[model samples]
Target: MNSRGFSRRDLLKAASSGFGYLAFAGLSSMAAGAGSKASPLAPKAPHFPARARRVIFLCMNGAPSHVDTFDYKPELSTADGKTSNRPGRIPGAKLMGSPWKFRQHGQSGLWASELFPEVAAHADELCVIRSMHTDLPAHPEAYLMLHTGNSQFIRPSLGAWTLYGLGTESDDLPGFISIKPTGRNGGAQNYGSAFLPAACQATRIGSEGQPIADSQIGNIRNTKLDAAAQRLQLDLVQSMNHDLLKRERVNPGVEGVIESYELAFRMQGKLPGVMELAGESPATKHLYGLDDPTTADFGRQCLLARRFVEAGVRFVELTHGDWDQHRGLKAGHSRNARAVDRPIAGLLTDLRTRGLLDDTLVIWGGEFGRTPHGQNADGRDHNNKGFSLWLAGGGVKPGITHGQTDDLGYEAVEDPMHIHDLHATVIHLLGLDHERLTYRYAGRDMRLTDVKGVVHKAILA
Candidate 1:
């Protein structure tokens, strides 16, 4: 396959420089978990006592309608067909009320529309932030901003930052796992490591709509080589990699490959069992709504997230769809809601029952919220001015709404929280002060929240 007629293995068969002995020693220790102390994925102490040991970010890719989902505004409902006189409002666009009814749920009685009845049942565990705002209304920009602190420039993602700071609890598994992510809008940028060590990047399991039933990690497996032969091959590859590093002096690429090979070696033994769900009870599958065809895809992601977190992964991200409905808001949002509602609720319940909820921060929201006003037709337009998201478990104050939009649900009017602040809070919950958790890159200190963001201490439990 190379320019040289012979393979490296074939060429190296006659050469010996103690490379085999050195690699075998390193891999043997690594397999026993003794070598992880020198690894970048080794567990590290937090900056402070962390409220959460892990994070699960439930990302709804397309903007979901805040007015229809979580931020129920009766005023917006009453003034359904009214045109806006507000500046910057689109011309002649009428306000559209949510097709579903809003009702109080759980002992907390947080207002949520009928679209998310399942999630509403866990209202007592939810800390709903009603007045969430972001930098842009556009999908690509806001989506990027929601994941990485900066939109215009490539930056480490939230998961990457978390993994970089905490270094994960497991050496056998990836620190960050992104499930069923969409390769659109922000694409890989949403989970990329950027200037951070490539080891901090997320290990994506599957794409958005693709069911990962037989979906194993795609490449690097040579069916012909057994575990021992593979290890020997990897030893040779790693020796070459280290040789490159010695020559180049500080090559992140080579360093990342070296680490990846070792991790892959260790993962081959554990990951297949983790991904297998045949052992899950029928009740467990039913709990996640996996029995239903409509909800199966997202349900699978949610369940895998739980398994991954339980297996000591530090951060897990599950993405579900283009919630962006510029037209047919009711039908589209309804379908989307039905798909994720039970699965999300099941995740909450499962975590709590397993005692994982106490330290597993669960976040649910999209890049932005759809506007109260219709976009020419019946659908809501993108509204970066205001939106909503909810946090549960971890250290968040439960069953309380901390902010609000105006009565018309047009924009955040009180206790408005920006995306930067949210990022700060997320990092804070994971025991890293966003300001202090910085990586030196390009002669500057880079952080998840950048120079912006103040943790919303009021929402802290």
Candidate 2:
């Protein structure tokens, strides 16, 4: 209960008036009193000490195959071309051996396939989770589950929740950012703050050319009237809104407008530095594979992600789309892998070299993994039963593989981690109580993990 003896739900009722409520009611309340640091995303002393301060989520939109990439099963090699009559979607699917070869690397003897030789160099930095499972096999549903905790309902994204719970390290930028996300799979709803304030929603910065064009302050014709002009305009607006607030103190839309305008004005000057890769040398760009045609686009995105986090953005999401390889498996997977391989490795290497890896959590995986068996005699279908995901930096054990799958790589035989568990562990790394970092919505307090989540302590360093 709050000081008002009201539950969080009651507070939401009191505060959730559209823009008017947010601007006048909420901001006014916050502004009326000085010395109040009440942003939902403000960093707080964790329940326990935290090992990570920021997160970079590399979201592979299409599922990548665990059997082909990270999890190597010797039995698949021997049982190549054999048919399996399992109770799966395809009645009699032919056994498929990985087209690539896996070799043990580093001191940990972690096996990485030829597809990601760049990432393989950092094998010792990865904690591979082989037994990861989810509820759905389809992209829309599974992607939603992976991102928003719930498959059906709109809710605060984990990034938004993180910001709300922890607050911003730099008030200039949005705490959550999503790069080149897919529009179809859950769309903007994936990153929407839902019940959380609009401030916590991801600031969508598109591919080069347009960098926050809408939010920047308009150009002033008179340079001489700069500060005085802005102050005069601001004061005029505030006076009008203040009078309006007296009549309707609970309008969220009105309140939201005022808050949005204020933040946007403040962000105008700070945004350019945040977006620019200011001092990045040509050598650094080339190392990230930006010089190569095949890898350039993804490379730019990865490099930008690093730049954003360096500027103190709390959460950064890097997304590349259309990994759904139902046919032409070799061509599809190879193209997808080549596009991101070097850039990803460069990000890891750059972070480690800059000493950011110690406090920055890096996650790599898709909505799910591909089925070992072919869907149409060529490509694999989506498989949510079992898959592989990996984490590096931010207190994760390096050069380790946790859990295993069946001989055919169909089922998780050990240490299965649900998506909820992954969410919980992520929150744990950032010093949040997964269960307690919640927003009141629809009469219940909604959390990222909901009622299901256990921290994967075994993988923690």
lDDT of 2 by residue, 148-251 (tens): 88898888788878877777777556567787667877888778777777667776656322322222223312233343344344444544555565568555
* lDDT (CA) per prediction: 0.83, 0.76
Predict model 1's lDDT versus the native: 0.83
Q: After superposing candidate 1 on the true structure, give the runs of residues whose Cα lies further than 4 Å from its correct spot.
A: 1-11, 14-37
1-461 in candidate 1: lDDT tens per residue? 22334467653652333223212111111331222225566677999999999999999989899999899889887988998777888877788888899999888889999999899999999999998999888889999999998899999999989888888788678888888778988888999889887888888887876785645675435455566556556656666776677778687766666777777778778777888899999999999999999888888889999999999888899998879888888789999999999999999999999999999999999999988888747688889989999999999999999889998888999999999999999999989999899989989998988889989999999
What TM-score do all the candidates reach, one by one? 0.92, 0.86
The residue-level lDDT of candidate 2 at 22 comes to 13
